[model samples]
Target: MALSVIGAGFGRTGTLSLKFALEQLGLSPCHHMMEVFANPEQAPVWLSAARGETVDWDSLLSGYKASVDWPSCHFWRELAAHYPEAKVILSTRDPQQWYKSISGTIFPAMAGGLPEEGPQRDMLTMVRHIVSDKVFSGATDQAHVLDVLARHEAEVKRSIPAERLLVFDVAESWEPLCRFLGVPVPDTPFPRTNSSEEFQARLS
Candidate 1:
């Protein structure tokens, strides 16, 4: 299936919640980093992409209707171009809060104990190449990270047509998202999940 929605946001920006929200909106089986973990075969593909190699996007994401978070989000431009009809969602949050969330959740986790070989290691290395190395330039300083996010948000805005993009914060819940995607707001509450506390708990 072609991707109907492309998440252009970095990780730790309510991406997990957005994944579930999109699924509930009928974009079921949304692809996220979690999908990569569950599908180890995908790690090599992503690692290739991280190293500037080309792969068939259609085959790689064949069954996914939407994708959020990393690995995919890093390829938003290519995906958007490949699937010209797809809408882009630029998920965002307060800079300070975003930095704090990643510091506690993603940064440490990436640096923590990881398998020495195989798919898990490939995934972690791919993540490092994409986020820590490329995006942040190997700097985790608050000011630099915030600047990168601001520039990334601006780049997405400039690259995508205004009508085709939604600068979303999950805290805003369903209204703007539903309106952007032209889907009815569901009766159930929006998903709220994968908080820093939850992430830390998972590591323990």
Candidate 2:
């Protein structure tokens, strides 16, 4: 099935929670970085995409109803073009808070070295190329990273049509998201997950 939602948010921006929320709202099988780790066979396809090679987005993302976080976020423009009917969610937060979350979680994960071979290393390499090299220019300084974050949010706002785009913060709860997607808000509370400490534990 085609993507119903395209999340143009970086990691640590409540993407994991979004993934879960989407599933709760019947957008099951949402794609995220965790999907890559779960399906090692998908690594090469993404690595090729990271290298600027042509990719069959349909073939790569088949079966997923929504996509978020890295890898997908890196290709959000293309996805938005491809799935014109899909709603784009630009999940965001205060720049400093966003930087702090990633610094304590995703940044360290990217900086942590891996073995020279294997799917995990390959996936990390692809992430580095897209996130570190392309997005951050291999810089980890807080100010620089926050600047990049601001620029990305601004770019998303400028690029996507206002009607189809929703600038969201997970803290806003489910009303806006459900309204944007024309779906009813679930009776349950919003999924709160993947905190900095939890992320570190997962890596460890």
Candidate 3:
């Protein structure tokens, strides 16, 4: 397969919008946590992958040309191992704003609702398992959240080739992304999504 795209961004980082944009750009068959939401059956498959247990990559990667958000984010290091040549996108936003958005809405929405057998459930489990390590830097505080972003940034820089790793801020629009991906720039504003209110309402 050609180089696939992986979103290393956490939830609430405009990953959904990016997923849609990539699809519009001809990167179809992408995977996202929302896919897990819509299809609960993929949970166990994701759980095994996140735990570094054996999984059928051919079957798993068969349908998706790209993957974003949780579970995918959780297993990025693993994905890097599998698709060593795949492009990695590190989506970022201001740390405080991200924390506010996540704490207020995203986390609340997913709590206690993921299916035990499906991918969504597996994502919830995987995220919780790694939040302290990946998103919180083994600590839980406002400072820790910032630390997570910083550490993740550093890790990606160290692990992936500079050319293979792209740092994209959703607010910056498509030009930079298009340039990096070698896709023609679409004549449209980058899609902005997942307001705090919208995320909060999902919880209800």
Error of 1 at 61 (Å): 0.4
Look at candidate 2 and give me any clashing residue pairs.
none
Cα error, candidate 2, residue 134 (Å): 1.2
> Can you write out model 1's per-residue Cα lDDT over 157-191, one digit (the tens) per residue?
99999999999999999999999999899999999
Per-residue CA lDDT of model 2 for 1-204, tens digit only, reads 999999999888999999999999999999999999998788788878878899999999999999999989999999999999999999988788888888888778888677789988888888888888988999999889888888899999999999999999999999999999999988899999999999899989
Quote the positional error of residue 200 for candidate 2 in Å.
0.4
Rank list by TM-score: 2, 1, 3
Q: Global lDDT for candidate 3? A: 0.73
**Candidates' lDDT values, in order?**
0.92, 0.91, 0.73
**Which sections of candidate 2 miss by over 4 Å?**
none
Query: TM-score of every model?
Result: 0.97, 0.97, 0.85
Report the C-alpha lDDT of model 3 over 99-189, residue by residue, as the tens digit: 8877776555545555756455566775555554445544556676667777877787788788988888878888878888899989877
